[model samples]
Target: MINLFDTAKRILNPFFAKRHLLGDDNLFSINNILSKTAALAFIRAIDKGIKEKIEKLKDIDWTKDNTLPNFPKSFLDEYGLEDKPILLKKNIIEKNKLNHPDITEEEARRIIGNALYKPETILKANPNKPAYHNFISRTDDKHSDIVLLELSDEKENYEVINYHIINNPARDRKVNIHKKS
Candidate 1:
């Protein structure tokens, strides 16, 4: 089986290496000289590889009680929380699918898991709802941001109440979360 990452690195290494020599402005000019078909094929291979990875990560059964582990120490310490059990209720999962028909239930769950575990930006102590937090992370496509609302009353057990994807996190007024300074 061909390793897409290695293949991509091999193909892209030269372009990256030439950046210092050719300078940033002329670097991307190489693409204009390369065959468009090859570029399209490379993009397709990357897309397929990403989809396969996402499919593999869908092993978690969303219907059952799943406790996500490995809370980043920084996240835990900032929120004064522990690596406790977190639940994604079936109704919320169904609601997420209903709201975002572009993605499947498994994909929704996967996004939720990603946001919970590997959030790029977390907005804690939501101004409107003190018990709720917003965990924001990039989707697999990196074209959109997935935002998850986690509710924790006693700080022992948590539940994901809502989730949605924003097309542009930079322009989205609803996404108040910012990168930690």
Candidate 2:
């Protein structure tokens, strides 16, 4: 019920939180930086008295203040944030499970075998490959760049979920299909 997003916006924006430490003028993609920047805001909220804004947001007697800007009505009242404290740590954990089922034990793997992030790696020596031919592509090649195939983690710590990949316009993307035996 606490406008985590508004909280995020507050924490992430230097102009909002009035902290230049969050500033990174060198970064051209402010939008991209904001997403990553918001994560820190989430952390900051927990460490400080963001409870007031979070509380006021969560309290938001929607039955009364049901107008303008995010007008919290249905969800806020339903979650009972108007009546209780909501710790995101507990909520995010449980919510993740309800979101999806993990890949089955037998079907899953503990460790990722040899993986290829061809873009991050050294270009293969093959002279005539298409990767070497394009002028625009050569300037910013992701072929050898590491594409997080399998992330290493501790023990059985895994979760089920869904994801979608949005390709970088600068990088070439293609699906590899294998033929049936």
Candidate 3:
């Protein structure tokens, strides 16, 4: 479980770590440049990783009966130092079918499609719309906090299972809408 930023810093900081790289008059300026450079590098790495995950998911053979795949460890790993594997909530899928069988397939495809991009895409393209929703709650006994992405909305408040995050302050949240009986 490598911390992504920590790893990036370790790799990139040497450019700024040596005293020779810093200007005597303005150490603050040098530090700023180092931080910005490191941040950009980290973001690019993350974006690349996310794209890989999306491509992998796109390659799966989907069918009416086929179960959705779990989010790959490489992608979810961005969230934390530990492996934060994503679990697809089959029950929510079932409930979605029950609530609106007519639109279930379309919505499911929408989720898969919309999930292919970085969160920033939603932020820039559709600021008013939710970037994420709680499509499926993760159910790992070891990890209580699992991020469920809400991709799109269906009419009839079908998006209730979907929690908003894009423009909303709840962007950092991990939602578990399921109530244990």
Candidate 4:
């Protein structure tokens, strides 16, 4: 007689198995688009903008043609990513400061390049603290995804914190933090 458990798995196996039908390279490509380093860069740019009271993310001229931003030659050389088209946003948040007071472009890019890849979710958003920027990053799927909140001070920048991989980061993720663009 056929076992009941075996029969059920046989019927359900096709559905789950189909998910991995694509080759490994395809999966890698998808992940590359949301590279942890890219996310780190994205967060750093935002932090710099907010610290300098720029507030609006859209206003920053991060991309010329919705493509990569122009990076400094020193940054490119230090990272050994000269061939890579990806670069950090150029405009400084503050007109007075040529660069952000907190982190250098090189340090920011390196932080992105070195961040660990891990998926996370926004557990909380706090706008009450006028002196600090607070948010929590966590994932129900794994404990490894937990990350500390990003504070307003330069010392608590996301670059220094462990990077988080947010899968469905709808526009609402940072909605409360930034004013409407």
User: What would the per-residue lDDT of candidate 2 be over residues 1-181, giving only the tens digit for each residue?
Assistant: 2344544454345443344434345353334455645755754544343233323333323123111122122223432323222222233324433542452312111101101101112122223332221111121322211112111133122211111122344233322111110
Ranking by lDDT: 1, 3, 4, 2
Pick out the ten consecutive residues of candidate 3 with the lowest summed lDDT. Answer: 156-165
The predicted structure with the larger TM-score, 1 or 4, is 1
Q: At residue 132, give the lDDT of candidate 1.
A: 69
Candidate number of the best TM-score: 1
Candidate 3, pairs of clashing residues: 132-150, 133-150, 134-163
CA-only RMSD, every prediction: 10.3, 19.5, 13.2, 17.8
- lDDT values of the candidates? 0.57, 0.27, 0.39, 0.33
In model 1, residue pairs whose N, Cα or C atoms come closer than 3 Å (at least 3 residues apart or on different chains), thus clashing, are: none
- Rank by TM-score (best first): 1, 3, 4, 2
TM-score of each: 0.53, 0.17, 0.35, 0.20
lDDT of candidate 3 at residue 88, scale 0 to 100: 38
Show the colliding residue pairs in model 4. none
lDDT of 3 at 20: 56
Question: Candidate 1: misplaced stretches above 4 Å?
Answer: 1-57, 124-126, 140-142, 169-171, 175-181
